[model samples]
Target: MQTDIEVYVLSCPTENIITWLEASFTLVKKSTSGPLCSKLTLLWQGNEVEVTILEQAAGKRFTSIWFDSDKTPWEDDITCAKQVFKALDCEVRCNFQGWEEEGNQDPDLWWRINHHGEGPFIWN
Candidate 1:
């Protein structure tokens, strides 16, 4: 079974995405030891969480994102993630299906953010 989680998928350039992520959490170490792309280890919930920055295909200019953290107070991470979206002025496709497994439908919904202005622009 998966832990109760919220995954935020974003589309943005490398530098801007890194900037937003750095602002959201304390940077523990940046590992250029990876072959594909540099990985970032960040501090969240008093623990280290890893995030991979993947470059999208040509003509797309979008980036893929992922993170790992403990269960307690995941909401704090959610709030921080949203702040990154807003800071980057980028759209986000988010799913909280883990909430569904726990019979908590509130976070199980899907939403999209379009940055026409300062907003999440989330819709069901």
Candidate 2:
């Protein structure tokens, strides 16, 4: 099974997002076959797990993170997800399968999927 998540930014993104991400994790490989993207593997519970900046659009960015439902703690996985939000420093909508819907008080961290024509969504 594959676990995936997405973060969308409505405002223009800056280099700080990438800078912060690189600073937080280890980048193993960059994709040579598709759009400009990278492969990152992070150490969780003493094991290396694969994560990737699977998609990048003008205002929409998607991260592909994998977790074993039987073994990996959701807390650990979500902590990694929070890093993406921290790096962007802007309003972001997070979409990941399996979590119950709960409203947010902060506009900077939205959990629903709503997009305007301000920027590319990376994937169609």
Candidate 3:
């Protein structure tokens, strides 16, 4: 299982993200450092998870949600993306496979989930 989770969604509002977080986890604290970024501290399964939401992350239409902690519910970014897509009812994206600093991974390959379905695509 992954120690952290990070995924991107298309055009999701910050308020909606907070609402989903509040409903899914025990929110400890929330702070908006700027208009485009927000940080959330949450507790899940007796673990502290730090989540960061960054707007306009990809081409001004996508937002990044990064869960920095061990013991996150999902095993990898793709799994996490699926959950986010379902909860937020928006398009979500993640690397096609687990990322490694020195691994020979194709950067353009990505897993995407949306209202239509979920699949792998060459993200450009």
Clashes (backbone N, CA, C under 3 Å), per candidate, total: 0, 0, 0
lDDT ranking from best to worst? 3, 1, 2
lDDT of 2 by residue, 1-124 (tens): 2243344444423345446545655544334336645455554455555544444553344333333232233443334345555556454444433343574434333343333312213232
Better of 2 and 3 by lDDT: 3
TM-score per prediction, in order, is: 0.60, 0.44, 0.95
Question: Tens digits of per-residue lDDT for model 3 on 30-49?
Answer: 99999999999999999889
The better candidate by lDDT, 1 or 3, is 3
Root-mean-square deviation of each candidate, in angstroms? Answer: 5.2, 8.4, 1.0
* Residue 31 miss distance in model 3 (angstroms): 0.4
Q: Pairs clashing in candidate 1?
A: none
Top model by lDDT, which number? 3
User: How well is each residue in 1-124 modelled by candidate 1, as lDDT tens digits?
Assistant: 3343333445566677677768877899877545435578888768777777656522254455656554323464345446656677676655533344347555435545555533333333
* Clashing pairs in model 3, backbone N/Cα/C closer than 3 A: none
The parts of candidate 3 lying over 4 Å away from their true place are none
Candidate no. 3 TM-score: 0.95
Candidate 3 residue-pair clash tally:
0
